[model samples]
Target chain A: MQGGVIALVAEAAGAEALGAARGLDGNAFVVTDLQIAYLALGRIGPVVTSARVLGTGPDGRAGAVVELRDAGAGDRLMTVVNVSGVPAAVLAGSTR
Target chain B: MTSDHPVDRRTHVSDYFRLERWELPSDGGDERPSSFGGRAPIDDHQRGAGGGLRTGGLLTNLDTLGGFTSGLAALPRWIVTTSLLATVSELDHVGPLRFRADVVRRGRSSVVTALDVVDEGAADRHVAAATMTCAILDPRAMVLDFARPFSLAMPPPQADPVRPEEFFCIEPGAGPVTRLRLADQLRNPWGILHGGAVAMLADEAACRAAAAHGADASGPNGLAAADAVLHYLRPVKVGPVEARCQVLGTRAGRTSVRVAIHDVGAEDRMVTLGSVTVLAV
Candidate 1:
């Protein structure tokens, strides 16, 4: 579940970043990597994640870091994730 | 906790963990290329006083299994672990955890492997889900030659392996600093200290640093490392690697720490950067 959340955050952030680039022709970004450190368990209702783009590589890969906090748990840090993504078309055997 | 388990003292981390690899079906091409599956025991050596597999132990398992899967995906070209991420949902685990690894992506310069672990003794309860990213590089002459559908036999367990702290010879230094010797037993196939070893050191450093920051072990909020994210920028080919930890801050009983691992023998160059979170257990 945490992994899926991370990928969703990474893909959303990467799409926004890649959407700004001119030459790519609207390609969807796929999460390439995600490194996460689980801090505490989320014993609350909703877990929120905020992401900041670390940087974008020359080869169209974008890196970002995400932090997940449990809102019901006094916004305590739940996990920290480092994620990267590349255009779906760039993946091997991708028809896109 | 007593180290009563007789230490066999293996040379390599893989041997110490008794990681055994088995072949996976070559279905699901790029997305799920049934890469590698294996299993290892989580005995007293790998467990903490809390009776759960330590955070470092969990990271080590992720690193080891993911490394093999990604390395094999890279084939003739070797690979180096650039990043490792794992979220462990379950803490108390039964012995002999099983691992399933698959290729998520095989790109031009990198390979990403996704791994899932389950407790074999606990009726295959989910233990962790992790991903490893490796930078594909020219192997030169250090390429691994393995037959198709490669399988490695589990080394006979003579006795319980030494704990990571003892195996790595980790000792506390001044303040939040921890020292790890780059002994041959800690090195990987590339003749460098394994990434798992680095993660273990970082985890240890984070816990110690949190303790230094008033995270009382006997307090209402006892501290232990819950999660760690490591980015391997360079390899440690020299000895006396130091993990210098700095407490980022504490929030709601959780402390964040940044650890910079440097190879003192290599002119104190930073080899890995780690972010660890210590939580009240």
Candidate 2:
């Protein structure tokens, strides 16, 4: 559960899908589009969420890569590479 | 640099005040029609506002969406707004909704994508999740000044329109209430996420179904949803769940889709069910 939380933090901090996620408005954390497949149930562990800005679209759609894994004392519960999110600035900027 | 042509046509906006200058047409008002060939059916069992998950934070500070620029530095702002603009709930009873996204496939003129959202730490529950594919927008074609005199139609989103993955497809192949989630986020203090949230999810799934219908059938005749009409079963408390989405078919250029968000544990039970009809433009 926290794995998803960590991933979201990266997104709010200006991280794209790779770096983080997009916000719905005001450049914070926007969940424009999303799809998640439940691989396994929530498990306690040091889930490591790392993101990197993959690329930016000419229209302001930036992509990022997010990798989540339970880095605690257990097996890798979930390995999801979500390719989603629209930059908050993309929408907020238009308001200018 | 600033909001000029070419450079301003599709570059990042450095200021918030400048973004608001792109006034949205007030004529259409907030009531966007749900039908093209026909109007979307308004359900009778729908739950009125004041319950369920809400859009929360983002609705209050929509300007934040403008600050972001797609990875492509030269894209226009409106394109970003329609194709990539996202929202989440944060800091309140339904506090802290976070969003994430990325592009999976890129076409010469469009792009395929996906994304996810979670509680910012409120109640410590991953309430909802979703995936989407938005196309790249061109600044040359769409102008804020030109859009100034527009109605409500914010130009059809220029998407890859092609399915990047079979999973992302929302085209329903079964019954009207397929792939409905059993559990969802139940933190809408502002009553923004309940019925409205249901409508949003249903619309999204229906849109996917519409796109698939358009691609598969190919033609001005293919059917897509003119609007997604949802009847709220109830404002059931969402206790962490994923709904199932099913695509129906395209009829008269209107693609109809159905989805039910229910409890993750009780897949058999239903929370909300509805269908969307997208017209093939």
Candidate 3:
């Protein structure tokens, strides 16, 4: 797999994970730095990813870790950690 | 922007950016060695079976295409890549692969270009994306200026270096060092070894080193690259460029590797440097 594609997936997963953690309905974060570790080849199907918030900065920047797995086989495909900038409103739980 | 005449093609906004296309052949035989040092026996398990274009192939194309786009943006001048980073989440090996690139940022002294490898059927879905940073250099400043030499810290050379034929089409060099004899197919439009090719060589070298370091103990498929950063220092115009890689470290299932590229005939003058990280998945 191309690293560029992996980065894009990681970026998307990061945003979703952050949004879910904050109980928001929409994503409003921008990725800054990303690190990914490919674990296995993803079979043809929907890729399942789970994200966890690692930490959050005072300036509304947060770090998260996400894991991507093959939906069909449930084999972990890759792990990604990234930092993103979030809107203050979303971080404060004021925006849905 | 100023125009000399009305209704002139040069004055059109579309004239600032140009689109180009290329076709790369697949079916290149796998020559990659099972591991470095040729100590491990080549087996089916070591050679995982799945045929498509290698990840390196896509990187090669991205480098060339991204560079081309940046050059077009440079216009009346030329630009050279300072660094390139590509992240691929998916793989597509089907033939007649098509992609498009656009100049995302045109600064006074630098140009940033982005490329997307789209699905042949669904044009909106991009399978892969890449970005390149190129430095716009003055034509008159193209002359080489030597910098003070410095020493590099590297591990001792391997006793039984892996052969080149087993990993790449390039000529075999000394132990732990792979060499690529410059050929027409390997050259970019500028008649030099393309940056993507350089990145491929570096990635191969780093991957081999990581594999040799026992990072593949996790499974038989070997370590999959997480990401890579390549910095082009000089152009490779001579034949038989050599690539040397060293395993920097392995921690938390992540292996860090560093690779250096040099011209064999030029007293091993460094031409490129790259760092790659892989997970022992």
Top-scoring candidate (DockQ)? 1
Give the native contact fraction of candidate 1: 0.09
Model 1, residue B49: distance off in Å is: 3.5
Q: What lDDT tens digits, residue by residue, belong to model 2 across residues B129-234?
A: 2222233445454433433222221222223222111112223343333232322121232211233334444544454544543434453333322223333454
- Two-way DockQ contest, 2 vs 3, winner: 3
Is candidate 1 or 3 superior in lDDT?
1
User: Could you give candidate 2's per-residue lDDT for residues A1-96 as a string of tens digits?
Assistant: 754765454444334342233334424434332223223334777666555444433334444444455666355534343333444444454321
Candidate with more favorable, higher lDDT: 1 or 2: 1
Q: Which candidate leads in lDDT? A: 1
Listed for each candidate, the true contacts retained, as a fraction, are 0.09, 0.00, 0.00
User: Which 10 successive residues of model 2 chain B have the least lDDT summed?
Assistant: B33-42
Q: Would you give me the overall lDDT of model 2?
A: 0.34
Candidate 3 chain B: minimum summed lDDT over ten consecutive residues — where? Answer: B32-41
Choose 1 or 3, whichever is better by TM-score.
1
Enumerate residue pairs that collide in model 1: B11-B185
lDDT of 3 by residue, B136-238 (tens): 8765533332121211122233344333233334553334466676654455445567676686677566666777777644644555554566778888888
Interface RMSD, candidates in the order listed:
16.8, 15.5, 14.6
What is candidate 1's CAPRI-style docking category based on DockQ?
A: incorrect
